[model samples]
Structure formats: C-alpha cells, structure tokens
Target: MKNIKLIIIGVLITLSSGCSPELESVNFEEISPAIFPQSEDDIEALVAAAYYPLRGAWWDGFHTTSERGVMFINDATTEILMGDFSVQLYATFHSFEPIHESVTRFYDDFYNKISANTLSIDLIENSSANENVKKIGIAEIKCARALLSYELFDMYGPLVVAPLELLKTPLNEVPLARLSNDEMVSFIEQDLLDAAEDLLPPSETNYGRFSQGMARMLLIRLYLHQKRWADVEEQANLIMAMNHYDLESDYVGLWDTQAPVDSNEVIWAIPADYAGTSENQWQLMVLPSNYPVRGGWGTIQSSWKFYDSFEADDIRKTNLIAEYVGTDGVTYNRSNPGTNMQYGPIPLKIAEDAARNTGITTVDIIVYRYADVLLSKAEAIANKNGVPSQEAIDLVNIVRNRAQLDDLLLADYADIDTFNTMILLERSHEYWCENGQYRADLIRHGKFSEYNIDLTGAASETAAHKTVYPFSLDRISEGKGEFLQNPGYN
Candidate 1:
C-alpha cells in the first residue's frame, strides 16, 4: 500500500513538472496516456493518483484538519472556530472580498485536480488492462472527481470543468465559463452514481479508500445542500440498509490516539501518520504555544458562545478543553483567559498526543460517519413529510443517546421549522470540528448570516449575498469578461 501511495505521489510530481525536452542527450520516457498505464499496477497507480489531492498534506491536500484545509476554513466561517489572524477574522466575521487570499486559496490550489482526474479516467479506459480493472479504476477516479468537484461547488457555486479533449492539448488558449447550477449538480451526481455501482462495499474496502458507502454519503450531502429532502432520505436509507455501519459506543473514543481507522461509524477517514503522505495537526492548530503536553502554534479557537451551547454532561464536550495549565505555570480558562481562552476554549477535537514531539499525529481525519446519516435522515424525513415524524425523532435520539443526552420528544419539535432548528443545533454540536459541514448546514437552513451576526456582532458584514463566497480577483481577470463572478461581488 505504501509503495502504491508513493507511486501516486510520483505521478502527481511528474504531472506538475514534465521532463525537459532541452536535455536531448538524456533520453526521457515521457509519461502520457498513449504509453503509460498499460499494466494492472499502472492502472492502479493512476486511480491512486486521483485520490492524492484529498489527502491531509498541507501544501495541496483539501482535507487537512489545519488552517490550510477545508475543515478549518469551513469551520472558521461558523461559530465553531475563531482566531486573531487576518484570514480567520475574514472567515469568522464574513468580511471576505474577491481579493482575499484565503477566500481564493481552495479554488486556486485544487481546481486542476478535476481535469487531472478526468485525464486519469481517460487513460484507464484506453488501457489494455482487464475489463474489471478498467471498471474499478474508472469508478474510483469518477468518485475522486465528484468528491473534489462537490467540495469546490459547496464553496463556490458552479465551476469551469474542462473536457478531457481540451485537457489533452497544451496552450490551446480556450477559455471556458462556469457550468449552470443544474449542469454542475448533474455532472457531480452522475459521477457519484456511476462510481457507486462499482466501488467495493464498506466490509470489503480499505479504511481510507473510497467505497460504495462513501459515494452514497456524498450523494446524501449533495442532496441536502440542494434541499432535495426525499432524495436525501432515500440515499441515507440506502446507506443505513448497508448494515455495515453504526455509531461508536463512546463519543470521545472516536478521536483517541489509538482510535480504530475502521470504526463502524466512520464512512470515510483520511489516514494520517506523522512521517508521511498525510498528516493530522489538529492539536497543533488549537493547543496553546506554551501547552505543557505539546507546545503548539495556538492558531485558532472555538467561540465561548459555542462552548456554552453544549449540554454540560455531553461526552463530546469533554474534548473541548475549557481550562488547562500552561508550560509557563499559568492557568488558562474563561475567567482567567490569559491569551488563548479569550477567543474561547481550545477546540481540541482529537486527544493530546503526549509522546509526539512534532505537529503531525497518527489520528485519521474522519470525513463522513454513520451519525451524520442518521441525523440527515431525520432532517430529510421531517422536511419531506412537512412535519417531524416519530421515526425522525428516533433517528436523532440514536446520536443524542450516544452523547449521553436524554431522548428528545417528538411533541417538542412539532413543526418542520422547529424540527430543522433542532437538527441544525444537533449537527453543530456533533460534527463541529470533524469535517466543517456545519457552515453548509447553517447556509442550507438560511441562518448563515443571522447566526454569525448573533455570535460575532458583525451585522454589517453578514448578508444573504455572502452565502456563496466570491471568486478570486485573479480568476475574474483571467476570465476576460467570459467568467462572471458570483452574485453580490464586484
């Protein structure tokens, strides 16, 4: 597996920096679709390459738990995280503009992977490998492309997806416009659907690789974003019927240093190691610079408002450190917030790795899990029926029960609006620092601006137009009047 991963990384490097034709004396075996990926191992490597950008690497990986990745950026946009840095303030207070580097970072960094995956799929299809290999390879690549596209689309509305034919030619100078909203949704939906047919089931798939459940989970999320309540319920039900997943018995145990990568609850997790292809730096991101266990950069914090919102006895809240003694012999807490506590509690979602001397750890970054499916079904059922159902309430209680909270009564959440509010809050508490989908949840419920305004008092900066972020100024310039920016931005 390590050899395959290294080969994939090599493929990415070769793609980025092609062999120089100027060195004519040195014969170069140029890698291209026409010649490479002819063997089974080659096809496997190509598929693995499609999965590379989604790893936890700081430079380009999209799912790193740290500030550079989607989890931090998305969580920062909500009350889940706050910071003193310019980019953190921009995200937390909704003060982002077209020129803000952080606002444009995701798209600028990973958009090329869409075409890269497309090229991989094309190569695998044309290879002389067996039909089964080709089928599986194509499915994995499609899933990777869809996952990458969905993340980008969730932030920036549609994207300019270049065709494989166009990608094959260099210096073509053909500019493209972003897809229509429906077109973009259909494009991603079709890819996921296709991938789900060939992906291995959860019981058969490796921990970090994409599976049938992962593909369906992505569908559930996309449907939730589109407000297709019936579709969400259907997809969530399909996953539930897989009978291969369940919530972890202990809520906090999920993030322990020895947490199982193949936990029944985790649908998809990026496997990380301190020395490797992927890394998890959550401790470093939230821990104080003088923290006794492991000194960290203290880059971001959870808001006090968010901390106080949790039920006192909730086991999930145990991970959120409210007070701790620093290496300087100073206690940091809400009352005596030296430098870190003022922002809020340390949002240490993962347990402290005392043995580690570096920023990265072996903690696998959980993306989609079974609890999200249950809550999503609950939300979908209520919305689809126009009222909270007994089944819906039960689904939610399953997750709440794991948190050691009492079951919520159906009568308490009578209407769709009331039920949705409860669901949103439940989601916020359950998945805050996990994958950063709470921001999308707030936006889907039309509370993005309102919640931020109430939490941060940034009334002037919070608005409906800020629901989808603006395209970067550089992208707009490159569009040459062809690519229009998202609404409400110049």
Candidate 2:
C-alpha cells in the first residue's frame, strides 16, 4: 500500500497503486488512524486496492506484468501463444528455467498483492466504519486474498501465505513458510466461502467488485484444479443458478469497450479507463507490430497448430487474426510462421480499439466469463459421472453452437476419456490467452506433457517435472531453508 492512493471521489473511493514493491509498506499517516473514512465510499476505496495488481502496468515496454505475466507463462509455455524476438523472460517461458525473472516477478508481485490485501482487511476490520460496511469490506478483502492466493497456487503449486498481522510487521521481522498444497487450498476455500456470505449477488454488486458469483466461480476453478469433481460440479452449478450471467451472443463484440455494461457474459472483468492512465495494455502485446489499428510489438501470437485446431466455421478463428486493415490503408496478412521463439497468428480478441493510437486502449479485460462456467460444468459433470453425460454434452454444445460449430452429441464420443479431451480442447480454443486459462486447462486434462514431447535448444528435457514453476533462487536463498523450491527445479 506504499504507493496506493485512496481518493474519495463521487460514490466510491478510487483506489489505485503503481509499482508495488515487494517490501513496500503503507504510510498509515495518509489514511490516518484518527480520520479514516467511516462511510461506505471510503471503505470501498480500501477494499478496491486489492484489485490493483490484476491491472498490471506496461513496465518495460509491455513486458510481462500482472494478468499479462500470468498469461505469459500460461500461454507461452503451452501452444496457444508464442513469443517473438524477446529472449530473456517471455521468450524463455516456452522453455522456462527456474532462474527466469518472469517467474520470480510473478511470484514476488502476487505475494505483495496478498500482503497488500491482508493489510486492507485488517485496517477495515479495525476501522470505526459501520458494522455493515466492515462486513462487506472484510468480505471483499477475503475474496481478493482468495483470488490472489489461487493465482499463486495455480502457478507455484503451494505457497508460504503471510498472515495479516505478520504482513503488517516489517518483512524482515517475520519468517515465511510455504503451506502444504492441501493447507493452501483449504485456506483459499475458507476465504471464498466467508466472502460469499457477505458479498452481494453478481447483479447487485458494483461492476468489477467481488460478488457471490465470483466467489463461487473461484471455488469452481479451484475445485477443478484439485480434481474435486463433486465440488466443481456443485460450485459451477451454484454460479449458474445465480441467474445473472450468461454467454454474450456476440462473441467478437463481447470484449468491446462499448459492449453493454450489463453484459451477462462477464462474471468478473477488470474495467480499464477510456482516457486516463488506467487503460488496458493488452492490445500492445498481442496485436501485430505493424497493424494500423493499434500497432503492437507483434510479440504474442497464436501457434499454427492452435490456428489450425479451429473448425472452419468457428467464429473464434476469425477473432484470431491472420490479416487486418491498418490505419495506413495497407492490408496486413501474416505469412511468416516463425518458430516458437518468434511469430505466428495474432490474437485479436482484444483487437477492436477506437483509441489504439493513443497509447492506452479502453478495452475491458475479461477475467472470468460465463462461457467458462458452462465449459467447466461440462467437464465437471463428465468427470463426476465418469462418462460424457447428456447434460455435459449439451453444455459443450452450448459453447460450440455459439461459435457456430456443429453441435456435439454424446454419441460422438466413445468414452469419458475422449469426451473429456474434447471439452479441454474446447476450453483451449474458447479461452486461449484470456488470463492463462489455457495452461490450467492443459494441466487439468493431463495434456501438459503432450506439449513437452518435442524440445530443442535451452528447453531440452525442460518438461520433466516442470508443470509448475520453480521458486527463484533469490526467494529460496532469502528463505534460508524455510522456503522450499518446487522439487524439480533444484
């Protein structure tokens, strides 16, 4: 919270942070103990700080940070997105090592976020705010914590989660120890469950704030990762029953800044400002370096295999562009299919921007969408029943139909194995590079190793026990044996 600004605006307090250093500590004098806000607006500002890390900055010319960092590892390591020319961090992820700065930064940034949110929770609880305000504030903080912890766990497996009181203490004064996977998962689940109790339902909650549906969505994803099939099914169904969210009919238009605010498709979206400094930076990373709309570095591209995987009629393929009209009145078509270390098809999911030339794009980055819930339901049901149930088939078909693909029938699949595979492939296409869901989906389907089957250069034999990221040497040395690296890295 060192650089965090708790601005008291109209209805809600605007909270924003910049370059959140790992050792950063809040100056209590700003939000003084004597005169902190007792109103809901102030409380909302305090809670909003928890989401700052998700809207990562373009530090180092759109270098990997925040959601981009997560997507970098998730997509680059897999086949959906490939790097171009960049060498040190982003390019190396496809063949990542334990020493990679990207992994370390991701580890550090997320922990700082967890710490920041923890501080917010404690401060909110101790404040003289209304009891109802305290409840909601605390609930939102817990949800934020849960989301951050889940991201860490998804990347690093298990972690040393610092408690609120300990985080308040100077970093040097407290010793951190990694939680066992089960311990971490239990902690995450408890936070989500508690947050759900106080959080408003999706429709009632302000846009971008944590809600009951988001809590359930997180629980569903967590359960899916843990192979808690029954829990996944239960949580997914619970979110579906919220009756507030649904897949947007316009697949390409869903990411539009002008898209309806009440879009039932988005469960949780990190809203970016249209004109201010808070604009989304995603367009610069995935858009072609020469594309006229919002010329990007042309760095992140879809794999040819990925581009080929789509059915001919799938609308998503069109969204994954191979050609585009630039502001220069020049038509650009991708012909050079560079190696994994270079270019391929560009992801145009966040491509349509009216303000691309202005250095900041106003596109709202979708964190969690209803389409995922539907697909997760399909996967969960298939897993729970040990077969492709008709319900599961219908759910998968719902997504495929939206993409204008032919309807999938349970009869098309011979057994649960093939059916589950199809659902995962569907997820890969539907959610590619959309906040790193592609990587998580791969691990869940046990297809992670399939990508590792071929290797060369610095990545040879890299897939061995490398499904999870390694703790940076810096983190482990700092731990002095208290923090253990993921087993394979050392």
Q: Kindly give the number of clashing pairs for every candidate.
A: 0, 0
**lDDT for model 2:** 0.69
lDDT of 2 by residue, 283-331 (tens): 7666655576557665566666777778888997776777666656666
Best by lDDT: 1
lDDT of each: 0.83, 0.69
TM-score of every model?
0.94, 0.87
The model with the greatest TM-score is: 1
Q: Roughly what TM-score does model 1 have, to 2 decimal places?
A: 0.94
lDDT of 1 by residue, 1-490 (tens): 0001112122433211111111222111356546667877677666666776788877777887878888898889898999877678788889888889877889877887888788778777777888898998898889999999999999999998887667666456666788999999999999999989999999998777789999999999999999999999999989989999998898887887884776999998887877656789888888888888898889999999999999988888897899999888988899999888797999998878888979888877888899999999999989988989999999999999999999999999999899999999899999989888899999999999889888888343877888888888878877777778998898
Cα deviation at 246, candidate 2, in Å, is 1.6
Alpha-carbon shift of residue 329 in model 2 (angstroms): 9.1
How well does candidate 2 score on lDDT at residue 178? 87
